[model samples]
Target: MKKIVLTSFALVGLLISTSCGNNKKEAEKVEVEKEQVTPTETESTEKETSESSTIVAIAAANENFTTLVAAVKAADLVETLNSAGPFTVFAPLNDAFGKLPEGTLDGLLKPESKETLTSILTYHVVSGEFKAADVVKAINDNNGSFVITTVQGGNLTASLDGDSVILTDSKGNKSKVVLTDVDASNGVIHAIDTVVMP
Candidate 1:
């Protein structure tokens, strides 16, 4: 009977020691993890805060994209484009829209024409982030021509003309990229000289 009692005490003491040891180990591990993660989290938060402007926000701030902004609003795609897409947008400047045939823009802005406008807008956006260097590399590596798939499920042929990037739409219409790599939180924008068709 005494042996059983002593054994039970011994077991209880052993369990207490083991539990204490495990708790100590967990505490140390948590501290180390917190230390490692804190700096990275802080840096990431600061960077995101600094670059908080999204593609829609950036476009809205600029006067050059006034027509494009209006079209986006008319199409009700402003929210979609403003999402966390990491999209690559080939933005058309006001001059580019002005190059459209007379009364074309007016017709497209009609409520009944929203579907076509949405298609045209989404055609300008690729689903992923692609910087200027990556684009150039892709073009150079692919025999000086790279095909970029747009969010609209159509493809745009990207090729270099001297030092400029030319985007040819599925309709075989050509648009010259004027400004490259306008960074946004959700994506990047490359201004084109013409509003390419789907």
Candidate 2:
């Protein structure tokens, strides 16, 4: 009888131990699932924030720059402009476009003039971020003159005269940086009264 009782007690203890081990294993699995889910959620949220911060478009503040807008779209450089770069754009207003001969804007919009138009528009862009103060400093460092290389493979001369900045193109045409440092999410825009050709 004692042997029977002893054997029954051993069986009960083994069953209890097995049941407790199973419960612990289930709890550990739940914890591991939670840990994996948390990191995935964090990574997805970070990606969304980074994408949302990018600039996707540009709006010209005047009718004169209509030519610029069309060229940007035609050159497929709209994506570059919409990127996350803090670019500095020398934006010429509508009156500046009028400086071009009549029908010039229309001609440039044609398919044949696409390449030329693209070059002209890219001549206005410079890589990296530069404010008015930085421009002035650059000019001062170069003895009131500095050369700026455009994305269009042209050189533009920047000159500082007291409080005014002058931009001269390769074609010997001059445009004053009438308004300096208009800040943008992707870059800076400087308003000029005249268009600079590449």
Best by lDDT: 1
Please report, in order, the local distance difference test score of every candidate based on alpha carbons: 0.93, 0.80
Off by over 4 Å in 1: 1-52
lDDT of 1 by residue, 37-102 (tens): 999999999766744588888999999999999999999998888788889999999999999999
Quality of model 2 by C-alpha lDDT = 0.80
- Listed in order, each prediction's TM-score against the native is 0.74, 0.69
Model 2, runs deviating above 4 Å: 1-58, 61-67
lDDT of 1 at 58: 92
Clash count for candidate 2 is 2
Highest TM-score among the candidates is held by which one?
A: 1
Output the lDDT of residue 90, model 1.
96
TM-score of 1: 0.74
